[model samples]
Target chain A: MADGLRVGVVGATGQVGAVMRKLLAEREFPIAELRYFASARSAGSKLPWRDTEITIEDASTADPSGLDIALFSAGGSTSKAQAPRFAAAGVTVIDNSSAFRMDPDVPLVVSEVNPEAVKEARKGIIANPNCTTIAAMPVLKPLHDEAGLVRLVASTYQAVSGSGLAGVDELAGQVRAAAEHASLLTHDGAAIDFPKPEKYVRPIAFNVLPMAGSIVDDGEFETDEEKKFRNESRKILSIPGLAVSCTCVRVPVFSGHSVSVNAEFERPLSVERATELLTHAPGVELSEEPTPLQAAGNDPSYVGRIRVDPGVEGGRGLALFLSNDNLRKGAALNAIQIAELVAQQL
Target chain B: MADGLRVGVVGATGQVGAVMRKLLAEREFPIAELRYFASARSAGSKLPWRDTEITIEDASTADPSGLDIALFSAGGSTSKAQAPRFAAAGVTVIDNSSAFRMDPDVPLVVSEVNPEAVKEARKGIIANPNCTTIAAMPVLKPLHDEAGLVRLVASTYQAVSGSGLAGVDELAGQVRAAAEHASLLTHDGAAIDFPKPEKYVRPIAFNVLPMAGSIVDDGEFETDEEKKFRNESRKILSIPGLAVSCTCVRVPVFSGHSVSVNAEFERPLSVERATELLTHAPGVELSEEPTPLQAAGNDPSYVGRIRVDPGVEGGRGLALFLSNDNLRKGAALNAIQIAELVAQQL
Candidate 1:
């Protein structure tokens, strides 16, 4: 395990997979040998790394031996079928899928918030929090520590890339179509002919979709993305009693996700105190006004617009807004950062 | 005032004011004489209504006599200066700006929620609620009627049209720029040359700005839009002590404004009951998955994604999302509806 670290990137041809490779190079992660894996369709394709081409192997039937660590960005079903195999082969798998995030034996880790929880991964598979939840962790960690956060109400303005490359292509195609017609912006919903939407339930060009992920059929009537916000926040924050209500809305942005968070804490906290604490918090940059475009290439959660919530009694609640790059800090970079933390243990 | 009614549209060339004229014509409101008013720049412009061309008069210096109702959508300063003069002339002024919304003498009306409050316009002036607040009223009215709503937490995805024509041009210009260089979508944030943003503080193309209105500088650190949500909701809902917290965000959509509302009531309400109530709620239409595009040219607030907030006790709270056209229902339609209600009294 000592010739630097043998690393494998599952789903190497996908959007977040591409970001994972870029972050691995940009962050200078210690890598001796790098392997790429994709589905059968992209198996024989080559992806550039440093000046060379690495051929992607089919992840469905690949040898997982001799790899010190594997970062899985494949879909949930693929990870459910393959992550255990890699973990069994003595490869520590850090998965970005939602498959094992709530598993008792698999620890969901945000590198900056709960790095200590990494040691509790008895399944040898550390789960990455959902991209939306990941972007919120660093911002909430400091506030939760100070006031003992009890509840969170969040409304998300998520990027299309959070859906996948297909989502990106859908938005881009529609934007081009709408640009050509120009009537799409001026008239009613059906005035302009958009390409039939195959990826999302509605048109993604110049619109805001309230439901992000497909609605889970359970009686709760919450989307998988909304449920993930609840379950993942409870698990990562280690607050069994923390109450979370979230509305996940997808906007037309390409790379960044922004959240409007109203957090209620047990102890009293003021806007000035919350802003002061956030100024020094790790992985958070306080700004006067934070937007997704500014956060697209940045790493920290750009937080601002802090105010007191009159809804929460006696100033125990604070409302703030934050934007973070969904592909970077939300998915790939966090997984790579967790792997780097794992390397220290090795 | 005998044969139909005389109507004047102040700021006739503006976005919401244009919609006001269109709606007045579409709804076939009883209009015997129609007049247009604007600043010195647009004073002489000719606007058509049916078969006649109406010349725009300078609102500041124009005699307000003989008008039955004046719908003012101009900026706050113009409204503040002109509304009282119209009121003194015995003309009912329905202002769309924030100028008279908080004035106790001027009743802030949402048509569906507080139609009875319209008769309390002591200053002979009625105020239209903020666009974001107007979007939520129809959706909230029924639920609040069934179960006494005690608290509200709202996060808004407001459109650029809420800012006026400059905002529309800025987003259009930036999208064209980003489209010309496709590398902007593929690469980082700096890869694109966006037009220098003149309307907003940040780039609104392919991005979300968390701060919609500039901070009011009242030491509360809230944007004027956020404050409007609180003040106007209390006035319209007749809930003086009802708690409210809101975060207003600007999205790239052209016309629709969507709100994610988590409302806590004193009485228990299930998703079934809430959906049933909303199905019959005036000015609200229940849909499966409501998006901004579908609501852009529509009159109703398209409400969907209703679910139970586990965060609230005993199913006393419900979380839902709604989209309504900012220019149509949010501003112009509501003002027109108030005028019709006032027409009955006339």
Candidate 2:
């Protein structure tokens, strides 16, 4: 685990990839050489890595032999096509997409929660858990380890940035267009209005869409984001029998994704002691006022509203609110942590 | 109880007050005479009601001699002063503020769920249930009747309109500023920004805030909105033993308040039957795709995502999402419904 390492970030011009670059610079990841790759659309785009400008190369045509490590933030389609090639070239691939996450061979790792899982990465590429799963794992791991997580009911308010740079730009444009008293009555995806809703189906300026991702099949009328919540939680926490029901919402928020979680544990746990435990827990920042904006750009998951359900005696049931940076801890931070852990494990 | 009744609307020019006028007109309330009253700021404002323009009078100093019913949507301070005065003059006050909702004698009415409670209102001022309560009641009532509701664990994504026009302007302004790429990072509330955050603590543009009300005394770290949720649900549902723990959040959405609720019932109820019941439930509209925008300007509480929780299967638990116009069903609509019901009994 020496200081110098060659690192390459795929989808360099995308949202998570841009943050990966920023985090590398901010966290001072000991990079001897840095390479940037993107799709043909953003092929020659210049991405500022700290003060150094790195020109993006087309990922499909780019040679991966020079890079010691490659971070993938491109969509699942791109990651599926290119990751194995990079991995086969002996580059340790850390993916931030859903492509190989649920593959039995790939180990889904969250550094602070499951650093040990990285050791089981037999397929060369280590999978990063979904943003929602990434956010909750830090907070849940400690509690789940202590009392054994029985059931989890989570309702997520996911920020637009989780979608991509397009998400941020779309929301920004909506905010601008909604400023002038535009008639919302005649302006829902119709005419005579704002940025024309390029990102979302509806005007996100003043609305929230409950359905996030296509309602892909796992049955129970669940969206792909909701399925990710269940599948990822099972993999990360190793709670295969865990009863989880999630309603993932796309809010007008920009960065961090916030979840209100009701967790029923096997044994009793007190709120007072949980607060004391979280104060000492790693990667879990305890906040009296936890909001999406406060958790934005931060690495730690901000947890608050620690209380026991009076319906359950001996504090077996607890409710909490947690917010995590969808870009950082939710994607780039976890990937960086995994890289750091890989530097240790390998 | 007749087909026509004299009705006076207090704080007519204000936010919820304007919606009260809209709902009343849209529903075709049998109004023999309609009077509009507002603060000194809106004393000369003209309001349209059922194809007639009503002249607004100063509510604080107005004579309340002959009105049959008075709906108050003004602030708590205004309600504290004017409600009793109007009530003393024999004009039944359907108050919309939290000033008197908890009072035992006052009937907190959500007409679809608790109309019978209104007949027992000895207090002239009948309290309108909290907006959150109003949105959740229709679905909970039928289910609670069939199987006793044991606990409700909820997280709310409330709309800005629930606060008032100032909130709408706050959200709109923050979006505008964020769009123009104005400074939000260093915004200390200096006067230059167009969407300068005036109503909330942080910029609402592309953000979700957990802090809705001032951190009041909740024994522990529970927010005022959280406490309101717990206490208000108890009063509205008439189930004191219903354990409720809620995290109230302000989303990027503009109009409707959406809630993710997990309720445990005494008898084992299936999601199939629950869906069938909620499909025909009063004031509740079951939607496969419910968004904050669609619920805006509509009165029905939208419900979906009905799934069975195996953890509480012995007690029959269902996870559902509820979205309703916070201004209408939550504030103005509920108040007007109470007025409509009270008009029948008068």
Candidate 3:
């Protein structure tokens, strides 16, 4: 414990927060002292750390002092109100919410793609990219380096777990209720009476919804998740003017987010070269047929189905598919990885 | 009955064949007589026509002397072996297989997109576009007419039924077997013992497989389904030089295929205009957020989530998502519609 740091896990009772707690121990993060913080409803409850239980503190009233780092997985509003206060208390905040990602003073980071950006966190807050965006960053970084990436068209097959625990419950409930009507569902999907959808606009079991998030009223009819993919990718890749078009869709799977990307670069990129680069790229594993199931409990982004995008001239375009665990690499694991980088500096 | 034509339905005992028989009665096609044909195994099986049962004939040995039009939903090899024989007997063949889709003489037709191309079937065979490709044709045709479409980047969320009844059975079996393991599947997808995959390379329950079909040995790593999307779209839209890049993925849904498209055109097209064009386009319907479940057992291609592709210059690009019944508008309905067109000409 001699050179270890004290850490706090905010939103400690949530889905992503549970993953954070598990990873912190699995990776053997150098923690001298650990604390858990949640909402008032869950405060004072005990959560296991390793061999002992830690009492959950109410995030609103708890003193975040003495903590060297705090990982916030609560919703955006909670982060908006609490992150700055923790940062002011001399703790570096690694936020998994969308609250401060677009803030210029805060660096949005995917640990493998832009670890150096950690040093640019002038506000003492590092933001993790959205799960869908994070899944593609590790795979696209090497390709972008080989060729000057100019444009990207991405379509996502996101899992229900990305919406948190409510999403998991919705899908599970629907499947349990509708699984017996396989014959009806096979022929007429709408004929089945699914449990009323609450987490999403439609039933998530045995179905694919093209709308993953609420539509932003920005006149573009684009979902917030789609905007996050474009904005976060541009910020992390350090290409402010990068052209992007994304469609975010939610599938019935419980975890792992998959993206199908068609990228055009200023310079020509061959399929063989892209394959070679991804084969050795950090945090990326080449798969023959990448699926959300194969990536649900994995850390690396499993990427495959690489081919030339016949749409772009001079072989300047390539198409690929990739999947990564939305909870681990997309959120908890990356936040902890950033914590590791921050610990070295401390 | 005097103006009605004699029709023969090849592969009349399979999945799409079942749909064709139902639709023929529903749409009230002008048929003087109807004959059923299938493989030798199912040859003598009796299928219900309007008010009577029709005995299935072995397609390989069937005599097509009396039929004026033959709709072939049989596999490519079966069509390759028997379609020409049917055509030689003075029957105009509307093939749902890929045997003659790319052939110079056989005009690949999507009813709403290029009905005029039906006259160019010099080999007496009009090919139905692939189910995945047919879903996008009506949606893209109206847009292309408004804006000279140049390039398309498509990522598909295809249903398992596209592979045939075997796909539906595989998904149903896995879901039924794994439904009780929802907790384990939600946490770790690979932890469950899903039924062995037969139609696909991975478990289709609670999973999204990026590879939809067998990979062609075309050195591009593109699946036959992906290639069909590119080739059939070009032929149906009559754009010989259209640049298309498609990633065909199979999801757990039983029916209906969905596509997310980012299209670049020669002219600038606004979202409002694109929406208006699609609203009035034949065989098309506009929904707020289209899902595959909504399109199942439906006729029109349900399209929504229309937006400007910020990637292309001067609003020359548009991004949209669409869903259509793969068995209806994609296969059976279109082939029957072509038969109606031929009946009118006769």
Candidate 4:
């Protein structure tokens, strides 16, 4: 216990930050001292840690020199501003935002897929892949190792929690307002009045919006979430030229994010062999039928419905579905795992 | 009005059958006389048609000698048992079931895509495509015609109504049971006690189920709904050798079914040209962001999010999304449109 490390959590009041705090305690991470930090608005508040309350520090103004590691789950802007400052103070930062993921010096690491890459973080900052991308890494890494994966067509069913607490609130409010009108929705979906949507472009209660993130105005018509899936997959898998077409959609589910992937490999990959590989794959489990409800609050990415994609000639294609808790394995747990890797190196 | 043809609707007490009756009146389908038929249990019941109550007749025992056309929205077994009987009695039968869709003697028709195929119904029975397949037909028809589509990868966000009234009841019951536990669900989805699911394998209220229909025993790991999309799309588009991979997922929405399609063509198809074609295509409308709520009770298939697939070489692939009313354009309205074509010939 005396050899334990001192750790700090940035944006400790946010949704993913809260999950990080819970998981650190649940997993019994080696911690000699724990600290919480948020914006100035939440700085003076106290958060409970191991039967004691710790005063929150303002991340923008606080000194992080004494901390061995800091997990950042604040938005991109906060990470862009505070990550380097904390890192320069000798605190290794495992950031869960997109701000530093694409930086060449800052390795984008999935703890299971690329934990060794943590040593390559010359900037003293390791970037955790996007939650949607993180869910697919553990599932795709094993497949890519067996057969050279060439092309991928992925369609996602994302949950509201990916957008944080506000998304949760919007979906909950709409569901409460419209649950009694389920009969009316069965006949005419638009007949009832839903509270005007604030977090999403459409109602997220009993509906699905194909646009998950705001579209990038580069005339490509791909959302940022879709782009992240393609970019982060290639970087983590070390397949620089991987062909990917991704459609990210927001569904009514609250916690889990699922993806239906049709992958074309360079070599012939049979369903049986793929299933066997996935059966033994780390951080993955095989299910008969994978649903978001089964994955919520779970650690492993549940994968199932493996089949040969007939669309690809010579049986070189495999189609499968996977679901994972967006908050657990997707964000906080992965960041914590990266921190663990850094701890080992230190 | 005097020259109008006599029409009959089978399974008039069912969900799609109710939509059939409503559309028949809304479209003013030149019905000189209207008749209703269902199973023996509903045979003696009364249904309204044009302000007049019509007593339902037993579909198994009814004589159809005088009716010019009969629309069947019953289950597959009912269609197989009664469609041939009605057709043998000189009534053209348009079936909304999977019973005869792959039958060579029966033409699988999507009214907007291949209305001329109506003449090839050699058995006097025309089959409407599955609701999930129907949602993509109008959106894909023009692009295929322009680019000679060769391969397709589709992932569906299907509504509960596609599963019939029981599915609707299961989802509604679960939503009503779990709506108040939204906060709990946002953190731990499985913590809430949802009603035991009957129509679906998993709770469908706030979850997405990857297995939409039961898996076919052919060892392909494909659901009947997924197989239907591949088989029906090939037949309707007249590309018998087209390669297709489809994943059918049931969402929480009630009425509209949506598909994300990545289509590869023999010739390069530009996003601009595909958008232009879809803009003018019959039974298709272009929207900025298409959702199920917007497509419910609508006649056209709403399409948007057109992009060039970076995975396909030479700009030969395009990606798009579409939504349509699963009950209307997918089942009931399509059957009625086929009836209209048969009426023209009669």
Instruction: List the per-model TM-score of the A chain.
Output: 0.97, 0.93, 0.98, 0.98
True contacts kept of 4: 0.82
DockQ of 3: 0.80
Model 1, range B40-140, lDDT digits (tens) per residue? 99998899888788899999999999999999999999999999999999999999999889888889998888898889999999999999999999899
Better candidate by DockQ, 2 or 3: 3
- State which docking tier applies to candidate 3: high
Clashes of each: 0, 3, 0, 0
Model 1 stretches astray by more than 4 angstroms: A183-190, B187-190
- Per-residue C-alpha lDDT of model 2 across residues A90-131, encoded as one tens digit per residue: 999999889999999899998888788887878899999899
The residue ranges of model 3 lying beyond 4 angstroms of the native Cα positions read B1-3
Model 4 pairs in collision: none
Write the residue-wise lDDT of candidate 4 on B1-346 in tens digits: 2689889999999999999999999998998889999999998989998888999999999899998889998899999999999999988899999999999989999888999989998999999999988899998889998989999999999999888889888877887777756555455676768867888877887789999888899878898888889999999999999999998999999889999999999999999999899999999999988898899989899999899889899999988889999999989998998888887887
DockQ of 2: 0.44
Residue B49 of model 4 has an lDDT of 89
Please state the interface RMSD for every predicted structure, separated by commas: 1.7, 4.7, 1.2, 1.2
Docking class of 2: acceptable
